[model samples]
Target: MGFNRPSRIQENALPMMLAEPPQNLIAQSQSGTGKTAAFALAMLSRVDTAQKVTQCLCISPTFELAVQTGKVIEQMGKYYPEVKLAYAIRGNRVERGTKIQDHIVIGTPGTVLDWCSKLRFIDPKKIKILVLDEADVMIATQGHQDQSIRIQRMLPTDCQMLLFSATFEESVWKFSERVIPDPNIIKLKREEETLDTIKQYYMVCKRNQDKFTAICNVYGAITIAQAMIFCHTRKTAAWLASQLCREGHQVALLSGEMTVEQRADVIQRFRDGKEKVLVTTNVCARGIDVEQVSIVINFDLPVDKDGKTDNETYLHRIGRTGRFGKKGLAVNMVDSQYSMEVLREIEEHFNKKILKLNPNDPDDLIKLEDIHN
Candidate 1:
C-alpha cells in the first residue's frame, strides 16, 4: 500500500487481473518485484465486504510464506477493516471446529485442502478467486500439485485463478496449462531473468574439503553485513552452521525437517540481525525476503536428483539477495570438476560470466565493496 508506483509485472498483469470478466493469469518475474502485492490487490478487489464467507483463497508453498503473504494482505487491506482474514498454516490460531468465517483465507495447499475436505472448516463453494503464490515452487519442490488440484476441484468451476512465480520450468508450464484455462500470460525473457544488481563471483577449491576453508577465508576477508549460505542438503546446512559457529561466526540453521516454530524463529532472528548468517537448503530459496542480506554464498551448487544442473534453483538462490533493485553479491564455491561444469552451465544459461575470487589476494575481496559502492 505504501508503494508509489507499480513494478513491471504489476503494471502489466494487475490491469488484466482487475479487468472486467476476470480472466486467469500466469505471471513470471524476478523476485522482490512486488508480485505479492499485485496478486493481493487483485484478490482484495474481487472480495465483497457484504459477504462473510471465504471468497478469496491464496495458497503458498511453505508455512512461513503463507504467514508472510497473510501479513501483506492484512497491510494492503488495512482500509477495509470489515474484510476478515484467516490463515491455515501450521501453529495458526484458528481454533478447531470453528467455521472459518473469514472472507479471505491464506494458507499452505495441504492445510487448505485438509480444512476443506476433512475438517470442513472452509467452504470451497463460496470461494470465488484462487491465487497460487510462488506457483513453480509449490508445484515442483513441495509436491503440492495433487493437493492444490484437489482443492481447486472443490471450488466453483467459474472461480478466477492466478499463478505467480519468478521461474517456471517446462514441466511446471504443462501443469499450469491444465490448472489455469485460457490464461493471460506475462513472462520475462531468459536474458531478463537474472537480476543485474547482483555482482556474481566464484571461488575455486581443489577438493570438497577445501570449500570449508575457502568459505572461512572469504568471510574473514570480506566485510559482510548480512548473508545467506545455501547448501544442497539439510545435513550439509547443519554441518556448515556448526562449523561457522565454532569459528566464532553468528550463524543459524534452517531446513524443512525442523518444526514450524523453529523455522519461524530462525527467520525472525536472521531478519532482526540477531544472526549474521543463515545456512539453509532450497526451502528458503523462494518466497523468503530479507532486505538486509547483501550477500549470498553457494556453499554447494544446486543440482537435481540425477545430478544435472538445476538452473531455476540457481536463480532463486541468488535472488535471495539483490532484492528490490539493491546492490548485492553472490559467491559460488566450486570444488570438483563436476561442480565447475555445473557452474559453467549456470553462467552460460544466464549469459553472464561469474568473476573468479582469489583468497590469497585481498584485492579480489575488495572488489565486492567496490561493486556495492
Candidate 2:
C-alpha cells in the first residue's frame, strides 16, 4: 500500500504468497529496492487484532535498521489503528513487562534474544510470521547463529518464514534451507557489473600517505554537501575523521568501537545536514541509507581474502550515493601499498577506466558537473 507500485520482489513474490497455498517464502532483493516494505506488508496482513502475543517478529542486523523499520511500521500501520506494535532494542524496555502481546515486534537479534530469555517478552510459539532482514549479513556477523537457531526452535512448527538478503552466499542459502521448509525462491535482477548511477573514478598515488593529500585536494576543490569516506579499519576511520575535523571540516566517525547510541546519533546528525562528512569502516556499508550523499571516498580499498578489492563491497560502497536515479560520484585512492593487480581487478570488474590525480595541477580537483551536463 505504501509505494502503490510494487517492487520487483513484490511484483513476483507477493501475489504468489497471498494466493498460493500457505508456504514459507525466501525473497532476495538488493537493498534500497524496497524489500523492507514487502515483508512488512505481508506481516501486517496476517496479523490479527484479537490475538496479539507477538504474532510477527522481524529481526534486523543493526540497531539503525531496527529503528528505521519500526518507524516504517508506525507510518504504514496508521490505517490499522487496532494493531499494536512495539520495538525491543539492546537497552530498551520490553513493552509493559506483562506481555500485551504486541501484534508486531521489531528488534535486533541480540536484544531480541535477551528479552526472550530474560524477560519472557515474546513467546515464539505464538509467532505466526518470522522475517529475517539482511539474512546474509546476519550470518556473516558473529555470535548470532546460536541465537537465531534457538529462536527458530521456539517458533511454531507450521509458522511461515521469510528470509531476505541482498547477497546470497552458498553458506547463507544452506542455512536457510535447514530452517525454512521447502519454499518458493525469488531473486531480483541485481545490478551485477557496476552501479549505473555513480560516476566512479580512481586516482593513483605514489604512497599511502600521498593518498590523503589527494583526498584533501579533492576536499578543498569540491563543494560536496556530504560524503562518506570508507576505511579498512576503525582506527583508520577515527584517524581520518579527526584529520578532517582538524582541517575545518565538519566530520564524524562511525566504527564498531563506538556504542550503538553514539553511531545512531552521528547518523542522525549526518542526515540532518549538520555533519558534512562521515568517515566509517565497511561495517555500516550495507543497508544504511542516507540521502544527499554526493560522493563516496574509498580511502582504503575493501580487500577480499586474497587481498583484492572485493567487487560486491566496492559496488555497495559506491551504491550509497547516486541512489534512486540520482547522480553520484565515487572516488578511489590507490597507492603502491596495494598491488597494481588489485587496481586492475577493480577496473576490470567494473568495466570502467580509473582516473588518476595530478597533484601539481590544482585544476584537476575541480568537480565536474553532472555527467549529462
Candidate 3:
C-alpha cells in the first residue's frame, strides 16, 4: 500500500512531502481522495521509535475525523510495532498521565488544548511533527483558532507542520502560513477538471413540495448500488432517510447527532454495500471515504448565510462519487430559481456543462467525456 500503487493525489504530492529536507506541506484535495493514508504513512515512516515522548500531533476539527484518522494511524503502525498510538478526544475515559504520552497523538484541538492547560498529560517539547487535518473546517467553524496558535507556540518552532484540506480557504492559508515555515503548497487537480469520469445531471422541480415526487422518480429510474443524499440540516437527513426507507430503499442516516460507534457502523454498512443510500449533512461532505458510493443525490442545495454554497462545497458533494478513477453519477434536485443559479455557478466554475434531464425520461444517462469533448 505504501510503494506499489500511488493514487493521483499521492503521485503528485507524496514525494515533495517525504523529501529528505521536508518542506512544510499544505495540501488541497477532495474528500475520499486518500490524503489521510498518505500523511499517515508519512508520519509513521518519519517518527523515531527509540526516543518517544509524543513525536507527532495530528489535529482535526471534529471528533469523528480525529478518531477516524487515529484509527488509520493505529492500523498503519502495525508494520512497526514499537510506535504507540493515543487519542485525546472529549468524553473518553482513558487515563491521563501515562496514556497520552505515546509516540503518536491524535485529537480534536479543544481537548488537546484543555489537557495541556490543565497540565494533565501532554508534553509538547518532544513533538517533531504537527498535522492539521481538515484545515478548512477548523478555520471555517472557528473551533479552536486560539488553541491552535497556543499549541503551535508550545511546540518547538523547528517542528515540521503539515496541513491538509479538501478545500483551501483564505483564512486557512493565512493561518497555516503564520505557523508553517515557507510551506510548499500542494493542490491536486480541480475536481471538475480531473473528475471527467463522473456523470453529472440535474432535474428542475416546481417547488419544495415537488421534491418528494422527484425522489420517487429517481428511485424508480436508477439502480443505486450506493448513494449519498445531502441535506441542509441533521433533521432533514434523518427524515429523508426514514422516508426513503419507508419507500423500500435500503438506507441509512449520518449526522453530528450520531455517536462514534453509530457513525462507524453506518459507514461500515455503506462500505459493505448493505445500505444502498445514505442521507447525511455537510458534516459528511468532507474528508470521508466511501468506496462503494457510485451515486450522490443533492436533495437540497447547500448555502451559507449569504445564500452561496461556494465552489469547494459543490466539488465535495460530487466528489463522493467518481473516486479512484471509477465512473460515478451525481444528481442535483433543483426546486427554485436560486437553485438554478447555483447550478449555473457550478457549471461555470468547472467549465463543464451539466446535463439537464427529466426524471421520467428514460434517456438520461449522459457520458461526461462527451459533454466535455
Clashing pairs in 3: none
Q: Which portions of model 1 miss their true places by more than 4 Å?
A: 91-96, 189-192, 207-209
Best candidate according to TM-score: 1
- lDDT per model vs. reference: 0.85, 0.77, 0.77
Q: Evaluated with lDDT, which candidate comes out highest?
A: 1
1-373 in candidate 1: lDDT tens per residue? 5688887888999889998888899888776888888888999999898877889999988898987888788999899888999888877765678788888999898889988988889889998899988877887755598898889888888899998876678877977887888899998645344558888999988765677787787777767888999999888898888888999999999998999999999998998999999999988987788888888999899999999999888888898888777888899998889999999999888888888988657788677667756
Local error of candidate 3 at residue 267 (angstroms)? 2.5
Quality of model 3 by C-alpha lDDT: 0.77
**What is candidate 3's lDDT per residue for 204-304, written digit by digit as tens?**
88754466677777666656667788988887777777778788888889888788778878887777888888889887887667777877888887677
The ten-residue window of minimal lDDT in model 1 covers: 188-197
> Which residue runs does candidate 2 get wrong by more than 4 Å?
1-4, 95-97, 191-194, 206-209, 220-223, 304-309, 337-339, 349-353, 357-367
